[model samples]
Target: MFFYLITVLLGLYLGCVGMQLVYLVFIFSKTGQYHRERGSLPAGSAPAEPKPDFSAGVSVVVCARNELDNLRELIPLLLQQDYPDFEVIVVDDRSGDECYDFLLLEALRHERLRLVRVNETPQHITPKKFALTLGIKAARKAAILLTDADCRPVSNQWIREMARTMEGDKEIVLGFSPYQVKNGWLNFFIRYETFYTAVQYLS
Candidate 1:
């Protein structure tokens, strides 16, 4: 009788764990479907129709800390954007590496690229958020586009597509960000997880 009772308890625990796993899988699948659908929007369709003679200034803010390699790749891509009246602001958050130095060199080469050095960390706890706020305040343009050190626009027309959607009195413009392909099963799983989450939140 005691043996049977022990067996039943073990079976119940395993069954509960199995159910939880199945539930998680179902949630993840649904999330992935949503993200794929949202991100699959036709190019230039995500934003609203463009207005005539509506040219607005844009400020691209990039917050960096110990991202020298990524900066080297990302900065050039940003500089190559086809936007006629846009400025790139790179905020260096007290990086211990040569990221700031590289940025300084890039700034010298590119007139549109501006560098800001944050010598002391702020008390607010979120360094990236603080850096972004500073960038926005220093921005000369009215429209602000926030991106990361590791991210880059897909093409030169990315700005035009993003800007066209900001008509009327809209203050905030949220866009989709997709992950790049990487080797290894871990990376695949991570990207899958990210896609799933984006689908759930964005869609």
Candidate 2:
């Protein structure tokens, strides 16, 4: 009688484990399929309708704090986006370095580049949030696209893609940024966490 009971319990545990494995596989397949559909373009296909006119305008906002190095490298890329009637706003949030002067120079150079200087953060709010608010408030365009100063767009069409996606019923578009993979456990962990966060949000 004891031997029979042990065998039945073992079988039940294996059945539960098998079901969980099946569930995980189902979720994994669904996620890959969804992203593959959303993130890729079919061969020789044109957009169904004309994309929203670039003349409608877009504001690309970036809030920086002591990121002179990143700003130097990225501002040119932002200014060079292949979209018409768009503005790039960079808010200098208490950056102790020469960021203010650098942006001031850039603004003079580019008619569409606007610079807002924040010498101090308010008593209660975080610096990043404060700077972002100021940038958005100063934006000239109704549609706003935001990105970090440390990040670069994969293509010159980044602004165009974002502006087009915002058309009709889509208020916010979520994008994925992948870090450069390196040969180290720490890098591996960071990449894992990034994908894990994306999956968590997707779920």
Candidate 3:
């Protein structure tokens, strides 16, 4: 009986591993197919014209509970994006910290900055979700981009790069975000897991 149980468990484990390999291969094939299609246009067709610059207005929405320190770094990066038409909306979800006061000052300094204050959250919904909903609704533009307070863009061209993918009928675009590298086993594990999750979804 013990031998039979071990054999069954091993078989199940192998089956799960095989399924995971298959899924990864399938996702990778999709990426290859996309590139191939782009590379080989119809033989007789004229060269495709370059896509125009993304001029559509974009609104970046962020939800923060008590992330004032991180916000101080992230908001400046967001405001400095090189996009022509965009707005930054920060949602303060009843933070006990100095977030409300800081956002008030930022709004005054930058005409493109908007603030949404959330004093009460419903028992049925998460605070982040509730705050994001309010911020999105308050957005002046149709294209809404969501990010966290802790996230920092690597460059000012972040918005432009993201918007470039939204040309044509594309409704959604996902970008890669690896965790900041730190000198600890926990940080290493977290970064590895984040990369794995990004591969699983972004492919």
Candidate 4:
């Protein structure tokens, strides 16, 4: 009798777990469908282009803390952005790693690159947010673009697309970042999870 009771409880637990997984799958599918529909608008349906006026200034701010590996990979990409008139500001939030040193070296190599190191901690604030605020305050351009240290733009036209999209009192522009794919079942699961997240946000 006791063996039969234990078997029944185990089956019930398994059933609940299975049900939860099914619910999550259902939610993900719905979200992906919505994102696809919204993202598929025709190019001609976009807003009309604004009059040609030369806007030469832009500032790209990146916040980092103990991100040596990421800095090594992304700094060159930032410096190489095809934007004609822009500055790249890397705000180092008291990184204990060698990222600061790396930034110094890269700054010397790239005239457009600037480094801002915060040596002291804020009394009561998040370091990343504080660093970003400082970067914005110190920016020399009217337009400020924020990106993570690990991120890289897909092409030279990234800035062009972003700049052209801003017209007629548009305050915010939505952008999408694609994730790198890897091998195995875990990668498949992660991709599915990312798709689900994008769906929720886009919807």
Candidate 5:
């Protein structure tokens, strides 16, 4: 009789677990699904060019430490953004490499490009957080777009799209950056992990 009771309890437990899994798969859909066109206008007829939102000038902030190579490739992509009235701010956070020199040269060539060279990060604060805070504080515009030095904007309209999310009482916006896929286990695992995490969060 005890063995039969144990078997019954085991079956009940399994049923509960199965039901939870089914709920996750069918009911909860938070992070699992994403709206690709959430902030973008419908891509049909050519919409009238949006009037320059003077109140929403953007400051594009990038924090770098010893990333001269990545900066070279990505900075130009940022500087050439098709949006108007935005500035690109690159904060060189105590980099030992040629990052400062490169930024200095770039700043000279591009009027909208500015550089902030930090010689040291305070003991109480971590280096990256300090650099990011400094960049945000230094931003001239009310709107700020923060990204890493190594990141490349997928489109010239990247800032435009991100900025659009700030409309109508929205202060903070979150974005996802997918890693470049390569012919390796690491890339495959990363892709799988991303999908799994999204599913779990959405569920």
Candidate 6:
């Protein structure tokens, strides 16, 4: 009886692992290709009605709470996105750091940058959610793009790529956010976990 139980448990574990391996190899590997071909029609298919152009205007929203350093580095990269008509809105959620001052200066210099200052959050409300709400409300564009202050876009055409995927009836578009590579074992583990989560969710 004991031997039979051990064998059954081992088989279950191995089956789960095998299924996960197959999924990673076959399905997860296609994520990049799907992103690349999202808006394209099939090779020989008849032309369908034209989809709406979502890239005409977009609002890039960032909710920050005491994230001055990350914002300082990230804001410049966001401002440099290749999209023609877009605005970057940063919500300062009662930050104790110099984030508010920095955003104020940047907003003055760049007409495309907008700042929403959150002085305080109610006791019952979450700060990040509140900040994001304010930022989205302040947005003047039809499309809202959300990114974290700590994240850096891998390409200047990030907005363009995302907007392209929204051409059809898709109301919500999910994106992948990979962590920066580092030399430590923990970093490697974190990156792997992040990639795995992206695989499961993005697929």
Estimate TM-scores for all models. 0.74, 0.76, 0.88, 0.70, 0.75, 0.77
Ten-residue stretch with the least lDDT total in model 6: 32-41
The sequence of per-residue lDDT tens digits that candidate 1 reaches over residues 1-203 is 99999999999999999987886677646544644322456777664443623378899999999999999999888888887799999999889999988999989999999999888867866887888778888899879889999888899887777887687787987776878889999889988887766755654
Give stretches of model 5 more than 4 Å off: 1-28, 32-54, 194-203
Under the 3 Å rule for N, CA and C atoms, how many clashes does model 1 have? 1
Candidate 2 clashes between residue pairs 3 or more apart in a chain or in different chains? none
Where in model 1 is the C-alpha error above 4 Å? 1-54
Please report the candidate that would top TM-score against the real structure: 3
Q: Provide the global lDDT of candidate 3 against the true structure.
A: 0.89
* TM-score ranking of the models: 3, 6, 2, 5, 1, 4
In Å, residue 64's CA in model 2 sits off its true spot by 0.7
**What would the per-residue lDDT of candidate 3 be over residues 112-203, giving only the tens digit for each residue?**
99999999999999888899899999999868898999999989989888877777787888888889999999999999999888877767
Deviation from native of the Cα of residue 145 in model 6, angstroms: 0.5
Off by more than 4 A, model 6? 1-55
Q: After superposition, how far is residue 42 of candidate 1 from its true place, in Å?
A: 18
- For candidate 5, write residues 1-203 as lDDT tens digits: 99999999999999999998887767656455655443655668555555534568999999999999999999889988888779999999999999999999999999999999899889999999999999998999889999997678998988888886677677877776767778999899998887666556545
Model 4 lDDT vs. the true structure?
A: 0.79
lDDT of each: 0.83, 0.85, 0.89, 0.79, 0.85, 0.89
Report, for all candidates in order, the number of backbone clashes: 1, 0, 0, 0, 2, 0
